[model samples]
Target chain A: MNPLLEIRNLSFSYEGSKSLVFEALDLSVREGEFLLVKGPSGSGKSTLLRLICRLNPPLGGTILFQGSDITAIAPARLRRSLCYVAQIPQMIDASVEENLLLPFSFAANSSKSPPSREELRAMLRKFYLEEVEPAQSAMKLSVGQKQRLAIMRALLQDPLLLLLDEPTSALDQESAAMVFSIMERLNIEEGKTLITVTHADYKPVKKRPLNYMLDNRRLNLLP
Target chain B: MNRIIDISLAQLFLALLFILIAQISSFIYHLGLNRDITIGTIRTFAQLFLMGYVLTFILKSSNLWLVLLVFFVMVLSAMFIVKGRVREKQIPYFIPTFLTMLISYFATALFVSGVIVGTAPWWDPRYFLPAGGMVIGNSMSALAIALERLFRDLREQRELVEMKLALGANYREASDELFRKAVSAGMIPSINAMMGVGLVFIPGMMSGQILAGTDPLIAIRYQIVVMLMLVGSTAVTSVVVMLIVRRRCFGSGEEVLLR
Candidate 1:
């Protein structure tokens, strides 16, 4: 079977530097695979993810998704299918509901609209985010709450690929477990592909996930 | 009480009317600031009263030097406002504002008085001073918006702007969205005035001319000229300010101004 996502001969360097971070690196993920990437700080792990989302471009090499070059794809369409959840989410100055609905405002997702009111409440209830006060400002939410809100925003897009960069970094242990459990359910139960980069060796409740580590400017299997 | 000079009730009441107009302007923003209202009223009374007495003395003496001095004072005060508000350590904030205001308002006022209204001396107190004040006031506001936005855009979006450059967007394309936002913000108040004129409220210049016993038709014609000048001056000043400021804002490479 064809890989769901593929990176071939990817090489990059910061501007004004005669060094390569990931030289001639190749990786592939199958459908519904849970890949956890481990790396030390500044190992180009974050840069690799950013390049996958097209936030930054690789100096050389192509990133292909579903047999097509993602770099050549239109930005709006690529962003719709492949959502990048940043380590620190940037919320526009708006309400919680408004932020959740922001992705729908894009032309590609507008047809999806939003789930019905009941569906929205049900979805929020799963994450314990009850809509008790719709008019309250989103800035008032705690960091953990904002992170969850960012995840909800990504889920709202109905994206085929999820690139989560340290989603559980700021959460307490309990919150981290809840988030990981939800991610596992999405991967195994719902059959969505998830590529998460984390420092921890987290074991999912549903599916046993594959692991990779970034060391010596190369991605290698952990096991 | 040297400050307590003879003033008629009708003059005081007309002054109070303008004060009230300024006071009620906060309704649009829901900023029901009664203190702001009272302070604004007192300020308007003091300023207009001083100008009235000072100009009366100048008109009676008909001294050209005194009138020029008053114009100089206005320009200096305008420079102070721009410098304080912009507060840029790198650029001389006052120079851009002074040059912009002088070129825009002075040129328009000269054209209006010399060619159109045909006032005697072309710098007549009855014509040139008030016209210059109106044009300069609007230009100062537009410059404030443009300068504030240029500095803020540099500070806030350093990463995303750099990302745009990586994505094959040129310097022009990378900055175009931000430049458009800044220009739109600079143009908003004037656009609102255009939309609301003769519907929600009459502008101050037309009202003042009408109250001064000029024909309403002539007042409105002059008001139209002033409004058009305001739009022209705002557009010209913002573009010019952005062009001059953009040089200092960008570095040699993809690096942007941050700090």
Candidate 2:
């Protein structure tokens, strides 16, 4: 079976920096697979996530998504299929519902109707957030709630691949478990692909999942 | 019509005496502006004197080309000044900046000269050059404000823009909100001036006309027309600049071009 995303000889370095984060690295992610990448700080774990989603363009080599070069795909089309949730989540100044509905307001997602109120409530409930109202201001939410809201917002786009950076770093054990369960449902039942970069411990909800570590600018599978 | 009185050379020198008083006070107070004040006073004298001759020659010539050449020079100088004011030389600002200024100022100048003023030979230097100068000069200042705000916002709100892009937004949708804020800030000064005109302040154009022995009512009418022209030109130029800058802020790949 063909991989959903293929990275060949990828290399990257930030501007004005002498050190290279990675060079001549290769990676592949299968369709509907859940990938958990673990690495200590400054291992380029977050940078790798950014490179996959095209937020930070790769300095060298090519990233192929679904058998097509990402460079050749229209950016709007590419982003709609691959969404990235940053380590420090970004939120709009409006109500939580408005923030969630923002994707549909964009012309790129104009054809995708926004989730209904009941559907949104159900999604919120899945992450153990049962009381977050649509009209409640998003700016006033706690860091944990905001992180879940960002995940929910990413889900609203109905993307084929979800790239999350430190998805559970901001949550406690219980909340982290609930969020992981939601990710499990999305991967197993809904057949969505997920690539999460985090240093936190997670129990697999399905049969043995793949785990990898980035060291010295190379991705190596962990036993 | 009452004949306007011209100040004698002594009276003009009297004006310099006040500037001398300012220079001496600056020296007494240990103010660092002593050099700037002296240089500014000298440059003002030299520039106005040169402009007086240049204006006289341009008006005397009936050739439309000569008049347009002078107008073009004025617009170019204004755009260059704005570029320095914004302090953003890295961005390819010259093309969009110059194009917006030229189109806005010249279009307004033509409408005023051709339709409203109905001057014979619509490109008549006497009527169009001064009007073009005032309109283009004000538009330049307004555009500087908009461009400066845009540069700051693009840096500060980069995360928000990237989030929007990740949410399946096109560049235009992501930048639409900032565009409104920047353009409004640019147009606020002209709007405030319009609101206070005749009530809290008398504008320079009207004052100049009145001092030149024109009837106060006619001067007020001209001032109204000129103010409207300035407001329209500023609005158009500011909008155009923001549109172009917004597009450039995004890369060819539809990602936010974070510098």
Best by DockQ: 2
- Model 2 in CAPRI terms: which quality? medium
Which stretches of candidate 2 lie above 4 Å from their native place? A16-19, A172-177, A205-208, B16-38
**Segments of candidate 1 deviating more than 4 angstroms:** A130-135, B1-144, B147-151, B154-181, B188-226, B232-259
Report the C-alpha lDDT of model 2 over A1-223, residue by residue, as the tens digit: 9889999999998877877898898999989888889887999999898777677777899899999999898887788899998888889999988998988998788888889988988888876678898889999998888888998898888898999899889788887887788778888888889998988888886745578998988889999
Per-residue alpha-carbon lDDT of model 1 for B101-183, expressed as tens digits?
66766677777776677888888877778877886788778777878887787668755454333333344555676788887
What residue pairs are clashing in model 1? none
lDDT tens per residue, model 2, B43-162: 988988988998888777778988888899999989888988888854677888798888889999988887789998899887788789889878888988899988788789988988
lDDT of 1 by residue, A110-213 (tens): 56767766776677776657743445677888777777777777877777888888988888887778778778887877788888888765976657888898
Supply the DockQ value of model 2: 0.70
Q: What is the lDDT of residue A110 in candidate 1?
A: 56
Output the worst ten-in-a-row residue range by lDDT, candidate 2 chain A.
A201-210
- Residue A54 error, candidate 2, Å: 2.5
